[model samples]
Target: MTMSFSPQVLLSKVARERCIANIKELPKFALNDEGSKKTYASVLVPLCVVKEEVCLLYTLRSSNLKNHSGQVSFPGGKIDEGETEIDAVLRETHEEIGFNARDVEIWEKMPIIQGRNKEMIIHPIVGVLNNMNVDNLVRSVDEVEDIFTVPMKELCNIENHGHLKLQREKIILPVYTFGKYTIWGITGMITHLFLQCFLPESLYTNDFMRKKYTIGELMPSKI
Candidate 1:
């Protein structure tokens, strides 16, 4: 049977305090047990107020790019020598989305993540984009093909969430599908991490939650 999306689920709202408090005790990401030998990079997990709701910002890389062509990603790039995590994310955000450093309020530096598909240590920074107008932002023609946003409520909808399981490897990854974008790979993992802190248990649940519950009962998005 094709289960229907619940209309009674409460919408999840993004809270700065909630995010800060929730993630402190969480363990940092391991590099799939891979030893240190990867490039260092930084990406911004930008949250902005769109249409009176908190939305996540993302970019579709230009298909012409040398790496991860046409993939959906946050605004970021390799960290230059002597560059701190904040410096790299701010510079990349400005370059990719035309968001000024003054407009972004740095919130917290998330646990370190090393990409399995690529040899790179990614430092993900959570920042609040103030007075951001998606329409007014420019996408770099060279690196970014398109820029878009997804509301927190829409992302928390259980029907839109699933998993990617590797039978032989016994690996599981969270998946989120929003509109035409299918978030998987390392990007999918990052999105799941954000939702973990952004939404309450009543709204967002993932593989990490050991308790079993009906999907209908967990569908908390009003969208």
Candidate 2:
């Protein structure tokens, strides 16, 4: 049977009653500041219609970079001094992939995500893109190595997802592979949380949420 995954349906189902207010305060672990001072960052989770299916856009980072080099991630970077989270994400998106603020419709701000090392706090802002073609993008050669999208249906496929056991902690973390790119760590956690918004409970059961991760429900856009 064919599945319906239209933008309108997704917007209605994920954004109708959910909002940032539903999320509780940041946990104690996320608030730890005993070590290196935490840095602030933001990312844009872009949803667009591609080839008649809803897909999420991602970028392959240049391998020469100092941090998170050669990994697939959303378009974002550190929030600049005196800049709001939304401003930083939009600016980073433009700088990284030539995706201008005018080309995206701001939707909701997901919960703040703290990096595993406790050195960074990332704010994920969800938005819908006006364009879907990768050829249309003018990526920053110094930052982005490539651009791609994975259909939402593929992400929801249980067969396409798996777990990687952490040797040090003996804990398992979710991992997802799309084409040649493997998404794990902070990106993987964000993806898992985002999928929970619209995916069925039966499809995302134990495997996806074996370890609890904090993320706010989808909120309506004021933009």
Candidate 3:
């Protein structure tokens, strides 16, 4: 079974020892198609505290990009030769958001997921941004359109959660909404996974995410 903890449990203030230790203990998994031959990539599940509440930084992809364009996503990209996932995350995030590896405290890596094209696998790493200042971030005009952070508490709200049921496959893909941004697809799945670990049953249940729906389905994703 996966270990559950409060949202505050991931706060940077108490993350050094027991909290981080427990995080590493959680169940881990990854998705890979046997012998499919795929490229590798990584994205940072960047955590930071704003006004004493834990928040996650996100980016709006530039519409100019060819893949996953004009979408909401964590900063990440294809890994360079001889580079580790940690290095790729640090490098990509730095290139996209001007976040330095020195300021990031990597906690753990969550499950792997197939990327948008099904030709690349994404490794999502959890890390805390020590004293992050969003205003100071320099976004890459060629890749990122805008950047924003959503508090963990807001994500726990039931009103903000939903799913896209794929009729043919009989699978429900998680979805979330924050202001003008609609988070679905791989990004939505990543957020769903991250939130599940932080919320106890009594605090926040993914009722909408887990419930059986008789109607309203979305076709399989193309991007």
Candidate 4:
């Protein structure tokens, strides 16, 4: 089915309200540890017009990076001292891809996603970009190997989704593979959460749900 959502639609009042309302209904995870100190970070789920269609931007991390090297991820990083989550997301996006903060319109703040190490808390901030062209992105070669976009229609396709079985607790993860890039782990989790804002409730069953905990419960808490 063809989805009619566009960068403009994502910024519409109706869409924003629906997204926020859905987020409230969804379950939010928190860290399981009682005393483990947590490192906070933030990422921008950037939506922009690509080829006259709405698409989400993703980055290929440089292979030389120490963490999650050479992996596909959103433009983001660790929150700086005394900085808010929104500030961190904007700063990281600029530092990674040279995307100006003035061109972005913040829309939604997704639930916090905890890293596998159980000590890092990531805040996913959703936003729409203005006057963005993939070809014009000034990628930071030191941190980003490349930048790409996936249309909303392709992202919503059921055919593009899959699952990976875990070794512990029989946990399963929802995976999305686009071309040669495999989006899994925390990135996959964030993608799945964002999809919830647009996809029908029924589409999130069986392979998409990951486990009995529902898609939202797949990630543990960070609070």
Best by TM-score: 4
Off by over 4 Å in 1: 1-14, 32-36, 206-223
Candidate 1 RMSD to the correct structure: 8.0
lDDT of 1 by residue, 126-169 (tens): 88888999888988899998898987766776767777665655
| Evaluation by lDDT, superior candidate among 3 and 4 | 4
Model 4, C-alpha of 55: deviation from truth (Å): 1.2
Instruction: Estimate the TM-score for candidate 2.
Output: 0.81
lDDT pick, better of 2 and 3: 3
List the global CA lDDT of all models.
0.74, 0.72, 0.75, 0.77
Error of 1 at 36 (Å): 4.8
Reference-based TM-score of each model: 0.81, 0.81, 0.82, 0.85
Best by lDDT: 4
| Residues forming the 10-long window of minimal summed lDDT in candidate 1 | 1-10
Residue lDDT tens for model 2, 74-166: 999999999999999999998999877888887778878878676889998888888656678889999988888988778877656766555
Clashes of 4: 5
